[model samples]
Target: MKTAKLDKLREQIAAIKAEIVSVERAQLTTPEIEARVDGFIQEMKRTVANDVLDSAGTLTYINQLGSGAGNWPVVGSWMHARPAIGFAMAVTLNPEAFRAMVLEAALKELNGGRQEHATGRVELVEQLRGKLRLLEQDEEAEVLRLEENGIDALRRADADPAVVLGLAA
Candidate 1:
Protein backbone atom coordinates (compact mmCIF):
# COMPACT_ATOMS: atom_id res chain seq x y z
CA MET A 1 0.00 0.00 0.00
CA LYS A 2 2.77 2.40 0.89
CA THR A 3 4.54 1.60 -2.38
CA ALA A 4 1.34 2.27 -4.26
CA LYS A 5 0.99 5.59 -2.49
CA LEU A 6 4.57 6.42 -3.37
CA ASP A 7 3.99 5.57 -6.99
CA LYS A 8 0.86 7.67 -7.04
CA LEU A 9 2.71 10.57 -5.47
CA ARG A 10 5.38 10.24 -8.13
CA GLU A 11 2.73 10.39 -10.80
CA GLN A 12 1.35 13.56 -9.27
CA ILE A 13 4.85 14.97 -9.23
CA ALA A 14 5.21 14.21 -12.91
CA ALA A 15 1.99 16.05 -13.65
CA ILE A 16 3.30 19.06 -11.80
CA LYS A 17 6.45 18.85 -13.92
CA ALA A 18 4.47 19.03 -17.15
CA GLU A 19 2.64 22.13 -15.98
CA ILE A 20 5.90 23.85 -15.11
CA VAL A 21 7.42 23.05 -18.48
CA SER A 22 4.31 24.30 -20.25
CA VAL A 23 4.54 27.53 -18.28
CA GLU A 24 8.23 27.73 -19.13
CA ARG A 25 7.56 27.35 -22.82
CA ALA A 26 4.81 29.93 -22.51
CA GLN A 27 7.31 32.34 -21.04
CA LEU A 28 9.47 32.18 -24.15
CA THR A 29 7.32 34.94 -25.70
CA THR A 30 8.28 33.69 -29.13
CA PRO A 31 5.57 33.22 -31.71
CA GLU A 32 6.65 29.60 -32.07
CA ILE A 33 5.96 28.72 -28.43
CA GLU A 34 2.71 30.64 -28.74
CA ALA A 35 1.80 28.52 -31.71
CA ARG A 36 2.95 25.38 -29.97
CA VAL A 37 0.45 26.17 -27.24
CA ASP A 38 -2.07 24.47 -29.50
CA GLY A 39 0.12 21.37 -29.51
CA PHE A 40 0.08 21.31 -25.75
CA ILE A 41 -3.67 21.62 -25.82
CA GLN A 42 -3.90 18.58 -28.06
CA GLU A 43 -1.63 16.72 -25.69
CA MET A 44 -3.98 17.70 -22.89
CA LYS A 45 -6.97 16.26 -24.78
CA ARG A 46 -5.16 12.98 -25.28
CA THR A 47 -4.26 12.84 -21.61
CA VAL A 48 -7.84 13.54 -20.61
CA ALA A 49 -9.47 11.11 -23.05
CA ASN A 50 -7.18 8.40 -21.74
CA ASP A 51 -8.14 9.34 -18.19
CA VAL A 52 -4.48 10.14 -17.62
CA LEU A 53 -5.55 13.60 -16.63
CA ASP A 54 -8.26 16.23 -17.04
CA SER A 55 -6.28 18.84 -19.02
CA ALA A 56 -7.29 22.18 -17.54
CA GLY A 57 -7.72 20.58 -14.15
CA THR A 58 -4.02 19.79 -14.44
CA LEU A 59 -3.26 23.42 -15.14
CA THR A 60 -5.11 24.52 -12.02
CA TYR A 61 -2.98 22.12 -10.00
CA ILE A 62 0.00 23.69 -11.70
CA ASN A 63 -1.29 27.09 -10.70
CA GLN A 64 -1.81 26.09 -7.08
CA LEU A 65 1.74 24.74 -6.93
CA GLY A 66 3.00 28.03 -8.27
CA SER A 67 3.67 31.21 -6.42
CA GLY A 68 1.22 33.99 -7.23
CA ALA A 69 3.62 35.03 -9.99
CA GLY A 70 3.88 31.46 -11.37
CA ASN A 71 6.98 30.11 -9.70
CA TRP A 72 6.29 26.47 -8.93
CA PRO A 73 8.86 24.69 -6.81
CA VAL A 74 7.32 21.27 -7.24
CA VAL A 75 7.58 21.69 -11.00
CA GLY A 76 10.99 23.33 -10.78
CA SER A 77 13.04 20.43 -9.53
CA TRP A 78 12.03 17.85 -12.12
CA MET A 79 11.01 19.96 -15.12
CA HIS A 80 14.59 20.05 -16.35
CA ALA A 81 15.57 16.40 -16.11
CA ARG A 82 12.31 14.92 -17.34
CA PRO A 83 9.64 17.24 -18.69
CA ALA A 84 7.34 14.43 -19.82
CA ILE A 85 7.16 12.91 -16.36
CA GLY A 86 6.30 16.06 -14.43
CA PHE A 87 2.92 16.87 -15.87
CA ALA A 88 -0.10 17.46 -13.59
CA MET A 89 -3.85 17.99 -14.03
CA ALA A 90 -5.86 21.16 -13.46
CA VAL A 91 -6.95 22.23 -9.99
CA THR A 92 -10.66 21.53 -10.50
CA LEU A 93 -12.62 19.31 -12.91
CA ASN A 94 -16.33 19.13 -12.02
CA PRO A 95 -18.47 21.61 -13.97
CA GLU A 96 -21.43 21.59 -11.58
CA ALA A 97 -18.96 22.71 -8.94
CA PHE A 98 -16.95 25.86 -9.68
CA ARG A 99 -14.90 27.07 -12.67
CA ALA A 100 -15.16 24.70 -15.62
CA MET A 101 -11.93 22.69 -15.38
CA VAL A 102 -10.71 23.36 -18.89
CA LEU A 103 -11.36 27.07 -18.76
CA GLU A 104 -10.09 27.23 -15.25
CA ALA A 105 -6.96 25.44 -16.41
CA ALA A 106 -6.58 27.89 -19.27
CA LEU A 107 -7.00 30.81 -16.91
CA LYS A 108 -4.39 29.46 -14.54
CA GLU A 109 -2.11 28.63 -17.44
CA LEU A 110 -2.46 32.19 -18.72
CA ASN A 111 -2.50 33.80 -15.30
CA GLY A 112 1.25 33.76 -14.72
CA GLY A 113 2.03 36.03 -17.68
CA ARG A 114 5.46 35.98 -19.34
CA GLN A 115 7.79 36.84 -16.50
CA GLU A 116 6.62 34.21 -14.11
CA HIS A 117 6.64 31.59 -16.80
CA ALA A 118 9.98 32.63 -18.28
CA THR A 119 11.96 30.73 -15.74
CA GLY A 120 13.56 27.61 -17.15
CA ARG A 121 11.95 25.83 -14.26
CA VAL A 122 8.54 25.27 -15.88
CA GLU A 123 7.81 22.52 -18.45
CA LEU A 124 5.16 22.01 -21.20
CA VAL A 125 2.60 24.48 -19.85
CA GLU A 126 3.13 26.85 -22.77
CA GLN A 127 2.44 24.41 -25.57
CA LEU A 128 -1.20 23.85 -24.52
CA ARG A 129 -3.39 26.63 -23.08
CA GLY A 130 -4.75 27.98 -26.35
CA LYS A 131 -6.07 24.59 -27.34
CA LEU A 132 -7.35 23.89 -23.86
CA ARG A 133 -9.37 27.11 -24.12
CA LEU A 134 -11.08 25.69 -27.18
CA LEU A 135 -12.98 23.12 -25.15
CA GLU A 136 -16.70 23.03 -25.95
CA GLN A 137 -19.06 24.82 -23.58
CA ASP A 138 -20.61 21.56 -22.46
CA GLU A 139 -17.17 20.12 -21.75
CA GLU A 140 -16.24 22.64 -19.10
CA ALA A 141 -17.55 21.04 -15.91
CA GLU A 142 -14.27 19.52 -14.67
CA VAL A 143 -12.34 22.77 -14.28
CA LEU A 144 -15.15 24.37 -12.33
CA ARG A 145 -15.39 21.28 -10.20
CA LEU A 146 -11.67 21.56 -9.39
CA GLU A 147 -12.22 25.07 -8.13
CA GLU A 148 -15.06 23.87 -5.92
CA ASN A 149 -13.24 20.84 -4.56
CA GLY A 150 -9.85 22.50 -4.17
CA ILE A 151 -7.35 20.34 -2.24
CA ASP A 152 -9.98 18.49 -0.25
CA ALA A 153 -11.42 16.73 -3.25
CA LEU A 154 -8.02 15.92 -4.75
CA ARG A 155 -7.05 14.29 -1.48
CA ARG A 156 -10.30 12.38 -1.38
CA ALA A 157 -9.91 11.34 -5.00
CA ASP A 158 -6.52 9.94 -4.02
CA ALA A 159 -7.82 8.23 -0.92
CA ASP A 160 -11.02 6.89 -2.45
CA PRO A 161 -11.66 6.93 -6.19
CA ALA A 162 -14.58 4.55 -5.71
CA VAL A 163 -16.28 6.86 -3.26
CA VAL A 164 -15.69 9.91 -5.41
CA LEU A 165 -16.98 8.02 -8.43
CA GLY A 166 -20.01 6.90 -6.47
CA LEU A 167 -20.75 10.50 -5.42
CA ALA A 168 -20.33 11.78 -8.96
CA ALA A 169 -22.32 8.94 -10.50
Candidate 2:
Protein backbone atom coordinates (compact mmCIF):
# COMPACT_ATOMS: atom_id res chain seq x y z
CA MET A 1 0.00 0.00 0.00
CA LYS A 2 1.18 3.52 -0.84
CA THR A 3 1.82 5.67 2.23
CA ALA A 4 1.50 8.82 0.15
CA LYS A 5 -2.17 8.10 -0.37
CA LEU A 6 -2.46 7.36 3.35
CA ASP A 7 -0.93 10.73 4.19
CA LYS A 8 -3.31 12.42 1.81
CA LEU A 9 -6.22 10.72 3.47
CA ARG A 10 -5.05 11.92 6.85
CA GLU A 11 -4.80 15.44 5.53
CA GLN A 12 -8.27 15.30 4.09
CA ILE A 13 -9.66 14.06 7.41
CA ALA A 14 -7.95 16.89 9.26
CA ALA A 15 -9.25 19.44 6.80
CA ILE A 16 -12.84 18.26 7.22
CA LYS A 17 -12.51 18.37 10.99
CA ALA A 18 -11.17 21.89 10.79
CA GLU A 19 -14.03 22.90 8.54
CA ILE A 20 -16.54 21.51 11.00
CA VAL A 21 -14.90 23.43 13.80
CA SER A 22 -14.95 26.61 11.75
CA VAL A 23 -18.65 26.24 11.08
CA GLU A 24 -19.28 25.76 14.78
CA ARG A 25 -17.21 28.82 15.66
CA ALA A 26 -18.81 30.98 13.01
CA GLN A 27 -22.33 30.23 14.22
CA LEU A 28 -24.27 33.20 15.57
CA THR A 29 -26.05 33.29 18.92
CA THR A 30 -29.51 31.73 18.93
CA PRO A 31 -31.28 35.04 19.57
CA GLU A 32 -29.35 36.85 16.88
CA ILE A 33 -29.95 34.21 14.27
CA GLU A 34 -33.56 33.92 15.35
CA ALA A 35 -34.10 37.63 14.96
CA ARG A 36 -32.66 37.50 11.51
CA VAL A 37 -34.80 34.54 10.62
CA ASP A 38 -37.87 36.32 11.97
CA GLY A 39 -37.18 39.36 9.88
CA PHE A 40 -36.65 37.27 6.81
CA ILE A 41 -39.82 35.34 7.43
CA GLN A 42 -41.80 38.48 8.00
CA GLU A 43 -40.57 40.03 4.79
CA MET A 44 -41.24 36.94 2.76
CA LYS A 45 -44.62 36.37 4.36
CA ARG A 46 -45.76 39.93 3.72
CA THR A 47 -44.61 39.83 0.14
CA VAL A 48 -46.41 36.58 -0.49
CA ALA A 49 -49.49 37.64 1.40
CA ASN A 50 -49.70 40.87 -0.56
CA ASP A 51 -49.46 39.01 -3.81
CA VAL A 52 -52.02 36.42 -2.77
CA LEU A 53 -54.41 39.00 -1.38
CA ASP A 54 -54.12 41.11 -4.51
CA SER A 55 -54.88 38.14 -6.73
CA ALA A 56 -57.47 36.38 -4.59
CA GLY A 57 -59.26 39.59 -3.55
CA THR A 58 -61.32 39.86 -0.39
CA LEU A 59 -62.95 36.95 1.47
CA THR A 60 -66.74 36.82 1.90
CA TYR A 61 -68.22 35.55 5.15
CA ILE A 62 -71.85 34.34 5.32
CA ASN A 63 -73.91 33.19 8.29
CA GLN A 64 -76.61 30.50 7.80
CA LEU A 65 -79.33 29.20 10.15
CA GLY A 66 -81.20 25.94 9.64
CA SER A 67 -83.95 24.33 11.76
CA GLY A 68 -83.00 20.77 12.78
CA ALA A 69 -83.75 19.50 16.30
CA GLY A 70 -83.45 15.79 17.26
CA ASN A 71 -84.66 14.28 14.03
CA TRP A 72 -83.64 11.30 11.90
CA PRO A 73 -82.13 13.76 9.42
CA VAL A 74 -80.25 16.82 10.76
CA VAL A 75 -79.71 19.60 8.21
CA GLY A 76 -77.02 22.15 8.88
CA SER A 77 -75.58 24.86 6.62
CA TRP A 78 -71.88 25.70 6.60
CA MET A 79 -70.55 29.18 5.78
CA HIS A 80 -67.17 30.31 4.50
CA ALA A 81 -64.23 29.56 6.78
CA ARG A 82 -62.68 32.53 8.64
CA PRO A 83 -59.26 31.01 9.26
CA ALA A 84 -57.59 34.18 8.00
CA ILE A 85 -59.37 36.18 10.72
CA GLY A 86 -58.10 33.86 13.41
CA PHE A 87 -54.62 33.88 11.96
CA ALA A 88 -54.65 37.66 11.74
CA MET A 89 -55.84 38.02 15.31
CA ALA A 90 -53.22 35.61 16.57
CA VAL A 91 -50.46 37.47 14.72
CA THR A 92 -51.74 40.87 15.88
CA LEU A 93 -52.13 39.88 19.52
CA ASN A 94 -48.54 38.78 20.08
CA PRO A 95 -46.40 39.50 17.06
CA GLU A 96 -43.18 38.99 18.98
CA ALA A 97 -44.21 35.60 20.30
CA PHE A 98 -45.38 34.53 16.85
CA ARG A 99 -42.11 35.61 15.34
CA ALA A 100 -40.22 33.87 18.10
CA MET A 101 -42.07 30.66 17.40
CA VAL A 102 -41.28 30.94 13.72
CA LEU A 103 -37.67 31.70 14.56
CA GLU A 104 -37.42 28.65 16.77
CA ALA A 105 -38.84 26.45 14.04
CA ALA A 106 -36.40 27.87 11.53
CA LEU A 107 -33.54 27.34 13.95
CA LYS A 108 -34.53 23.73 14.43
CA GLU A 109 -34.39 23.15 10.68
CA LEU A 110 -31.00 24.89 10.46
CA ASN A 111 -29.60 22.88 13.35
CA GLY A 112 -30.82 19.67 11.79
CA GLY A 113 -28.95 20.49 8.59
CA ARG A 114 -25.79 21.27 10.52
CA GLN A 115 -26.09 18.06 12.52
CA GLU A 116 -26.51 16.00 9.35
CA HIS A 117 -23.39 17.54 7.84
CA ALA A 118 -21.38 16.95 11.02
CA THR A 119 -22.52 13.36 11.18
CA GLY A 120 -21.41 12.84 7.59
CA ARG A 121 -17.97 14.26 8.35
CA VAL A 122 -17.62 12.04 11.39
CA GLU A 123 -18.49 8.99 9.31
CA LEU A 124 -15.92 10.01 6.73
CA VAL A 125 -13.25 10.38 9.43
CA GLU A 126 -14.03 6.93 10.77
CA GLN A 127 -13.75 5.46 7.27
CA LEU A 128 -10.43 7.18 6.67
CA ARG A 129 -9.08 5.97 10.01
CA GLY A 130 -10.11 2.44 9.19
CA LYS A 131 -8.25 2.64 5.87
CA LEU A 132 -5.16 4.05 7.57
CA ARG A 133 -5.14 1.18 10.04
CA LEU A 134 -5.39 -1.39 7.27
CA LEU A 135 -2.60 0.23 5.31
CA GLU A 136 -0.36 0.33 8.37
CA GLN A 137 -1.04 -3.34 9.02
CA ASP A 138 -0.13 -4.16 5.42
CA GLU A 139 3.10 -2.14 5.60
CA GLU A 140 4.08 -3.89 8.84
CA ALA A 141 3.48 -7.28 7.27
CA GLU A 142 5.59 -6.28 4.23
CA VAL A 143 8.44 -5.16 6.46
CA LEU A 144 8.39 -8.46 8.38
CA ARG A 145 8.44 -10.47 5.18
CA LEU A 146 11.33 -8.43 3.79
CA GLU A 147 13.32 -8.96 7.00
CA GLU A 148 12.78 -12.76 6.80
CA ASN A 149 13.94 -12.80 3.13
CA GLY A 150 17.07 -10.80 3.99
CA ILE A 151 17.99 -13.28 6.75
CA ASP A 152 17.58 -16.25 4.36
CA ALA A 153 19.77 -14.52 1.75
CA LEU A 154 22.48 -13.87 4.36
CA ARG A 155 22.43 -17.54 5.43
CA ARG A 156 22.71 -18.68 1.82
CA ALA A 157 25.68 -16.35 1.25
CA ASP A 158 27.55 -18.08 4.11
CA ALA A 159 27.03 -21.56 2.48
CA ASP A 160 28.78 -23.03 -0.60
CA PRO A 161 27.89 -21.20 -3.83
CA ALA A 162 27.28 -24.59 -5.55
CA VAL A 163 24.59 -25.50 -2.96
CA VAL A 164 23.01 -22.04 -3.33
CA LEU A 165 22.79 -22.46 -7.18
CA GLY A 166 21.21 -25.97 -7.07
CA LEU A 167 24.48 -27.65 -8.11
CA ALA A 168 24.96 -29.61 -4.83
CA ALA A 169 25.68 -33.38 -5.23
Candidate 3:
Protein backbone atom coordinates (compact mmCIF):
# COMPACT_ATOMS: atom_id res chain seq x y z
CA MET A 1 0.00 0.00 0.00
CA LYS A 2 2.81 2.38 0.83
CA THR A 3 4.58 1.48 -2.38
CA ALA A 4 1.41 2.20 -4.36
CA LYS A 5 1.05 5.58 -2.67
CA LEU A 6 4.73 6.34 -3.35
CA ASP A 7 4.22 5.54 -7.02
CA LYS A 8 1.23 7.89 -7.18
CA LEU A 9 3.18 10.67 -5.48
CA ARG A 10 6.05 10.25 -7.94
CA GLU A 11 3.59 10.50 -10.81
CA GLN A 12 2.18 13.72 -9.33
CA ILE A 13 5.67 15.17 -9.04
CA ALA A 14 6.38 14.34 -12.66
CA ALA A 15 3.13 15.97 -13.73
CA ILE A 16 3.92 19.10 -11.73
CA LYS A 17 7.37 19.33 -13.31
CA ALA A 18 5.82 19.09 -16.76
CA GLU A 19 3.31 21.78 -15.89
CA ILE A 20 6.08 24.08 -14.73
CA VAL A 21 7.91 23.61 -18.00
CA SER A 22 4.75 24.31 -19.98
CA VAL A 23 3.96 27.47 -18.01
CA GLU A 24 7.50 28.72 -18.44
CA ARG A 25 7.17 28.30 -22.19
CA ALA A 26 3.89 30.22 -22.32
CA GLN A 27 4.98 33.85 -22.34
CA LEU A 28 2.64 36.84 -22.15
CA THR A 29 4.35 38.79 -24.94
CA THR A 30 6.23 37.63 -28.00
CA PRO A 31 8.94 39.73 -29.64
CA GLU A 32 6.47 40.79 -32.32
CA ILE A 33 3.94 41.92 -29.75
CA GLU A 34 6.61 43.86 -27.88
CA ALA A 35 7.75 45.59 -31.05
CA ARG A 36 4.18 46.48 -31.99
CA VAL A 37 3.43 47.92 -28.55
CA ASP A 38 6.66 49.94 -28.67
CA GLY A 39 5.79 51.27 -32.09
CA PHE A 40 2.32 52.27 -30.91
CA ILE A 41 3.76 54.03 -27.86
CA GLN A 42 6.21 55.99 -29.99
CA GLU A 43 3.47 57.01 -32.37
CA MET A 44 1.24 58.08 -29.53
CA LYS A 45 4.05 60.13 -28.01
CA ARG A 46 4.62 61.96 -31.27
CA THR A 47 0.93 62.62 -31.76
CA VAL A 48 0.44 63.81 -28.20
CA ALA A 49 3.50 66.08 -28.28
CA ASN A 50 2.40 67.67 -31.55
CA ASP A 51 -1.09 68.25 -30.20
CA VAL A 52 0.29 69.84 -27.02
CA LEU A 53 2.62 72.06 -29.02
CA ASP A 54 -0.31 73.26 -31.09
CA SER A 55 -2.15 74.15 -27.88
CA ALA A 56 0.76 75.67 -25.93
CA GLY A 57 -1.26 78.78 -25.10
CA THR A 58 -4.00 76.65 -23.51
CA LEU A 59 -1.46 74.70 -21.37
CA THR A 60 0.16 77.99 -20.31
CA TYR A 61 -3.29 79.19 -19.25
CA ILE A 62 -3.92 76.00 -17.24
CA ASN A 63 -0.50 76.26 -15.63
CA GLN A 64 -1.47 79.73 -14.44
CA LEU A 65 -4.42 78.12 -12.68
CA GLY A 66 -3.92 76.57 -9.18
CA SER A 67 -4.56 73.06 -10.56
CA GLY A 68 -1.83 72.96 -13.23
CA ALA A 69 1.62 73.68 -11.81
CA GLY A 70 3.99 72.21 -9.18
CA ASN A 71 1.27 70.48 -7.22
CA TRP A 72 0.98 66.72 -7.86
CA PRO A 73 -2.54 66.21 -6.53
CA VAL A 74 -3.83 69.25 -8.39
CA VAL A 75 -2.08 68.06 -11.57
CA GLY A 76 -3.55 64.61 -11.07
CA SER A 77 -6.99 66.03 -10.57
CA TRP A 78 -6.58 68.22 -13.66
CA MET A 79 -5.46 65.17 -15.63
CA HIS A 80 -8.52 63.31 -14.42
CA ALA A 81 -10.65 66.26 -15.39
CA ARG A 82 -9.07 66.69 -18.82
CA PRO A 83 -7.33 63.48 -19.86
CA ALA A 84 -6.49 64.48 -23.47
CA ILE A 85 -4.89 67.81 -22.64
CA GLY A 86 -3.06 66.44 -19.60
CA PHE A 87 -1.72 63.47 -21.54
CA ALA A 88 -0.63 65.73 -24.37
CA MET A 89 1.28 68.03 -22.03
CA ALA A 90 2.84 65.12 -20.18
CA VAL A 91 4.05 63.51 -23.40
CA THR A 92 5.19 66.84 -24.86
CA LEU A 93 7.24 67.96 -21.87
CA ASN A 94 9.40 64.80 -21.82
CA PRO A 95 8.68 62.18 -24.44
CA GLU A 96 11.34 59.72 -23.30
CA ALA A 97 10.24 59.82 -19.65
CA PHE A 98 6.63 59.49 -20.73
CA ARG A 99 7.48 56.51 -22.91
CA ALA A 100 9.41 54.84 -20.11
CA MET A 101 6.52 55.24 -17.65
CA VAL A 102 4.05 53.92 -20.22
CA LEU A 103 6.25 50.95 -21.01
CA GLU A 104 6.80 50.14 -17.35
CA ALA A 105 3.08 50.21 -16.65
CA ALA A 106 2.32 48.13 -19.76
CA LEU A 107 4.93 45.51 -18.92
CA LYS A 108 3.68 45.22 -15.34
CA GLU A 109 0.13 44.67 -16.52
CA LEU A 110 1.19 42.18 -19.16
CA ASN A 111 3.41 40.14 -16.83
CA GLY A 112 1.02 40.09 -13.87
CA GLY A 113 -0.98 37.09 -15.13
CA ARG A 114 2.12 35.09 -15.99
CA GLN A 115 3.61 35.87 -12.60
CA GLU A 116 0.44 34.68 -10.85
CA HIS A 117 0.47 31.38 -12.73
CA ALA A 118 4.18 30.84 -12.04
CA THR A 119 3.57 31.49 -8.36
CA GLY A 120 0.82 28.89 -8.33
CA ARG A 121 3.09 26.38 -10.07
CA VAL A 122 5.84 27.01 -7.54
CA GLU A 123 3.37 26.48 -4.68
CA LEU A 124 2.11 23.24 -6.21
CA VAL A 125 5.68 21.97 -6.65
CA GLU A 126 6.40 22.66 -3.00
CA GLN A 127 3.23 20.87 -1.87
CA LEU A 128 3.99 17.89 -4.08
CA ARG A 129 7.55 17.69 -2.76
CA GLY A 130 6.22 17.64 0.80
CA LYS A 131 3.79 14.85 -0.05
CA LEU A 132 6.53 12.93 -1.89
CA ARG A 133 8.79 13.13 1.15
CA LEU A 134 6.09 11.77 3.42
CA LEU A 135 5.31 8.95 1.01
CA GLU A 136 9.01 8.05 0.75
CA GLN A 137 9.20 7.88 4.53
CA ASP A 138 6.16 5.65 4.64
CA GLU A 139 7.67 3.41 1.95
CA GLU A 140 10.91 3.14 3.93
CA ALA A 141 9.00 2.21 7.09
CA GLU A 142 7.01 -0.40 5.13
CA VAL A 143 10.25 -1.91 3.78
CA LEU A 144 11.63 -2.08 7.32
CA ARG A 145 8.43 -3.82 8.51
CA LEU A 146 8.70 -6.38 5.71
CA GLU A 147 12.37 -7.04 6.47
CA GLU A 148 11.67 -7.57 10.17
CA ASN A 149 8.72 -9.98 9.59
CA GLY A 150 10.15 -12.08 6.76
CA ILE A 151 7.97 -14.02 4.27
CA ASP A 152 5.52 -15.23 6.88
CA ALA A 153 4.17 -11.70 7.34
CA LEU A 154 3.81 -11.37 3.56
CA ARG A 155 1.75 -14.57 3.41
CA ARG A 156 -0.40 -13.46 6.32
CA ALA A 157 -0.88 -10.00 4.82
CA ASP A 158 -2.85 -11.25 1.75
CA ALA A 159 0.18 -11.68 -0.52
CA ASP A 160 0.06 -14.85 -2.68
CA PRO A 161 0.78 -17.77 -0.25
CA ALA A 162 2.58 -19.84 -2.88
CA VAL A 163 4.93 -16.98 -3.83
CA VAL A 164 5.66 -16.12 -0.14
CA LEU A 165 6.30 -19.81 0.69
CA GLY A 166 8.59 -20.23 -2.31
CA LEU A 167 10.49 -17.04 -1.50
CA ALA A 168 10.80 -18.04 2.17
CA ALA A 169 12.98 -21.00 1.14
Candidate whose lDDT is highest: 3
lDDT of each: 0.42, 0.47, 0.52
The true-versus-predicted C-alpha distance at residue 26 of model 1, in Å, is 1.4
Whichever of 1 and 2 has more lDDT, that candidate is 2
Per-residue CA lDDT of candidate 3, range 59-149, in tens? 4564445543543444455567778756566555676776677667767666545432434556755665555445444444454565665
Rank candidates by lDDT, best first: 3, 2, 1
Clash pairs for candidate 3: none
Clashing residue pairs in candidate 2 (N, C-alpha, C atoms within 3 angstroms): none
Residue 143 lDDT, candidate 3, scale 0-100: 49
- Using all chains and alpha carbons, the TM-scores for the candidates as numbered come to 0.18, 0.29, 0.29
- Tens digit per residue, CA lDDT, model 2, 1-169: 2345434544554555555465554445566676676676566457445534443332321232223431211111111243353355456556788887887676775664433243355565566445544444443444345466562212212233443344423
Expressed as tens digits, the lDDT of each residue in 120-156 for candidate 1 is: 3333353343233222111223333545656222232
TM-score for predicted model 1 compared with the true structure: 0.18
**Superposing all C-alpha atoms, what RMSD in Å does each candidate have to the true structure?**
28.5, 15.7, 13.1
